[model samples]
Target: MSRLVKCENGHFYDADKYAKCPNCSRGAGPKKDVVMEGGISTDLDDVKTVAMNIRGNIKSGRSVRIPKVSGRTIKPSNEILDREEQRMRELQEKIRDHKDSLEEQVTLAKESYEIDNDKTVAVHVFENGIEPVVGWLVCVNGEEKGRDYRLIRGRNRIGRDSGMDVTIRKDQKVTREEHCSVVYDEKSNLTFLVPGNGTLTYYKGEMLRQPQQLCSGDAVEIGETKFIFISFCEGERVWKNEEE
Candidate 1:
C-alpha cells in the first residue's frame, strides 16, 4: 500500500519506504563553472574580417545568391480560340433558323385566311360573272318545306309570306312580310345577309345589325328557323340547270 506524504518544499510524494522525502535528494548535485568560447577580443577581430571580405566582394562586382522560380504563365492556342468562335457562330445560325421557321408559320396562317375568303370569292367571280350565285340556304330547323332555296345574283327575300322567295309557315317567329334578305355584291362578288325592318335575324351566331358578308360554312337564323349556308362557288363550279 502506498501512503502520501509532503516534503518540506511543499511537494507531495509516496512515503511508504523512505523516512525522508525522495524529492529532497534530487537537489544534492555539485555546481561547476562553465567557460564560454569566442571572447570579446576574438569576436571583434572575426566581425572585422567578415566586414572586410564583404566590402572586397562588393567592389569586385560579384553576383549574390537569389531564389530561382520555375513556373511560367500560359495562353490559349489559336486553334482553340477558332473552335470556340465557330461554336458561337453555329449557335447564332440555329437561332436564326428557329426565328425563320416561326415567321413562316405566321405567314401560312395569314395565307389560309386569305384563301378562305378573298381568293375563293375571286375565283367565283371569274367563273360565274361578277355577281355569282355563290351559295344556297338549306333549312335546318322549322317545318319540312321539301325544298332548299337557291341563292342567285340578286336580292332574295325570306319570310312566312307567300310572295317571299323562301317561305316558312310552321315557324311562328317568322314575320309575314319581308323578314330578311340575302343580297349579292357585284363589285366584291360576295353574298351578304341583310336584316329587314323590325325582324330578328342572325348571321354566324351573332345578331345582324347591318349587312354582313356570308362566308363558307356560316349559319343564318331567321326567327326560329336556322339555315346553313353552303358555298358551291368557292373551290370548283358545280353545273346546275337554268330552272334551278
Candidate 2:
C-alpha cells in the first residue's frame, strides 16, 4: 500500500514515503548509502532508518540511536541462577529416588514370584524340617477371630510368643511361650492336644488334664482364644513322606 510522507523539507517526501537527502536540515543523522527508491534522490537505505532517526531526535533532540531491545538480552542475576539450579537438583533427586524404589520393587517381585525367564529358586521351608501342614487351628473366638495356624508333622507349640510354632498374638491370656501344644502323629494320622504346665485349657467344652485326641471341628480354648481343629491328614488324604 502507498502512503504519504510529511517533513520540514518537502522534497524529502513524496506520495509514497519519506526520503531524506544528505544536505537536508535534518541531516544530523548518519550518512546513508544511495539507493534508488521510486526515482527520488536520497542516500538513506530505507525509510525505516529515517523513521528511527526522527523518533530518536523527537524524544531528546539527540542523534539517532538504537533502541534498548536491539542488542543482547540482560543476563540473570547470580542468586536467580543459583535458585534455578537448586530446584533442578531437588527434582532430579526425587526422580532418582522414585526410580530406585521401582527397581527395588522389581527385584523383590522377581525373587518372590516370577515367570518363565529364569530357574526359580524353590522355597524349602518344608524340606528344611519345617514339615508340611497336616492340620490347621482356626480361631473362632478372641481378637484373632478367623485366623488359621498351620499344624506341622511335629509338635506345634501354641502361644503368643513370636518364636512359637503357632504364634497367636492377639490373645494376651495365652502365655508367652508354650501355652499349649498340638502334635500331629504321622504314624497314626491323628492330631493330639497336650495341655500346658500351668495354663488352663478347655478341649471339647471340658477342662483338659492330659494329652487328648483332637478331631475335626473340635473346639479348644486357651486364654481367651478358642480354635476349631481342621485336619488335612485324615482317612484318605495325607502328604507323601519321601524320607519314610
Candidate 3:
C-alpha cells in the first residue's frame, strides 16, 4: 500500500509502492542507524566484556567447538539434556529410600527392656557353669517402689545348724531412716541376711509375715508384723548344697 511521506525538500510525497526514491537514492526514513546501547553497570563490567567478545566472534563468522568423549557422540541436544535430568532425579529417590531402611534396622537392633522395681523375678542364663547373675526387679509388691539404686554387699558366714559355711546371694540393704521392709514372694522359703536389728518382714501376695531372718518360701515377723519370703532368680542354674 502507498503511504504519505515527507521528503527532505520540504515536499509531501504520495507513493503507490513503499519503495526507495531513485531520484536522490534516498528512502522516506531516518538517515543514520539507531544504535541501541544497553545501560552500563560497574558490577557487570566482566560480563559485558565477555558478551562483547562473543558478539565480535559472531560478526567475524567464527564457529564454536564442542569436544566428544569416548563412547559418546556430539554433546546432547536440549531434548537429551532434559532426559538426563529426569534420570538423575530417579536415582536420588532410590538412594533416599535405601538410607531410610538402613536407619530403621539400626534403631530396632538397639531396643531393650527397662528395670523398674525391687522384686525377685526369674531370668534366663546365656551360658551354664558360670556363677549365676541374680536378676531382681526394682519394685516392691509387684509395684515400682524403689527410689534409689544402692549397691550393697554381703559375705557368707558359718551356719549354726550344719557346722558348715553358709552362702547366700539374696541379701538386700536398706537404710534405717527410710523404714523400708522386705516383701518376699518366693515359694521355697529360702533365707537371706537383713542389715538391721529388727526381724525382717516380707509380703506375700495376700498376707505379710515377720521372721527372725529373711528366707525363701517363708515369711519373717519382726514383732507383730509379718512379711513373705520371695525367691531368688538367677541367670543360670547351678548346684545347690546346704553345707556352708
Candidate 4:
C-alpha cells in the first residue's frame, strides 16, 4: 500500500519506491551534494550566490553596492526628518508656554493675598478702639535702656518718678515728676514738646523756652536722658499747634 507525499516543489506523488516526486523536473527535485576545494560538501541547489562581483570589488578597496530591501534599507528623506524635528520643537514650545502660564497665575495669586492682608490690617485698626501708634520715643540714655516708649494721642509725662508715663531713673538731673510733657492734640492733629516751668529741656540742640511743635526725627533731651522721636503718620497733613 503506497501513501501520497508532497515534495518541496508542491508536487504530490505516490511514495512507492522514490523518496522525492518523480513527476517534477530534476532542477526542482531533491538537492545534490557538491564537494568544494575545502572538502566541504554543500547542496548546490540550496546555496544562493550574488550576481555582482563582490569579491573583486572588496579586493580593489571599492565600496560594495548592496541591493536595497523594500522597507528595511530605505532611509527617510531630509524633508521627512525636518518635519519630525519641527513637530518636536512645537511640542517643546507648548510646554514652555504652559509653564509660563502657571508662573503668571502664581504671581497673581500672591499679589491678591497681599492686598487682602493689607485690607484686613486696615479694618482691624479702624474697628478696635486701638489708637494707631503715631510715633515712638527711643531711649538714647537711661536705666530703661534700649526700650521704646509709645507716643499715642494723649499727654505723655516724662520724669524720674515711676508714676510718670516715661520714667528716667538713671539720670539724677531729671525731676521727681513732670519734668516735661509730650502732648498730642487730636483736634489739631499736631504734637508738642511742653517743658515744665523750670525743667531743663532741649530740642534740636536749642533750649526749649515754650511749647514747641514737634515733628518726626526730632531730638529731645530731658536732663541727662536723650530720646529720638520717630513718627509713623507719614504722608499725612500735620497741623500747627497754636499757643494760647
Which structure among the candidates has the greatest TM-score? Answer: 2
C-alpha lDDT values of all predictions: 0.61, 0.67, 0.33, 0.63
1-244 per-residue lDDT for model 1 (tens digits): 3344545654334454567745457662222222224221222222333344446557867542222222233557889999999999999999999868756654443332223345545444444465445578988776743457777554667788888867777787888876877765544556677666435788888877666778777988888878888776543455333455
Candidate 4, TM-score vs. the true structure?
0.42
Q: What is the lDDT of residue 95 in candidate 3?
A: 92
Off by over 4 Å in 4: 1-131, 234-244
**Model 1: CA > 4 A from native:** 1-133, 234-244
lDDT tens string, model 4, 74-157? 457889999999999999999999868756654443332222334434432434446456678898765666878887555677
lDDT of model 2 at residue 60?
59
lDDT (C-alpha) at residue 54 in model 1: 48
> Which pairs of residues collide in model 1?
none
| Ranked candidates (TM-score, high to low) | 2, 4, 1, 3
lDDT of 3 by residue, 1-244 (tens): 2233434642233343335333235442433222222422222222332354456557867652222112222455778999999999999999998768655543332221112224212222123524332222233331223321221112122111232222111233322231222222123333333322222333342222222334345533322333333435322333342341
Clashing pairs for model 4 are: none
**lDDT winner, 2 or 4:** 2
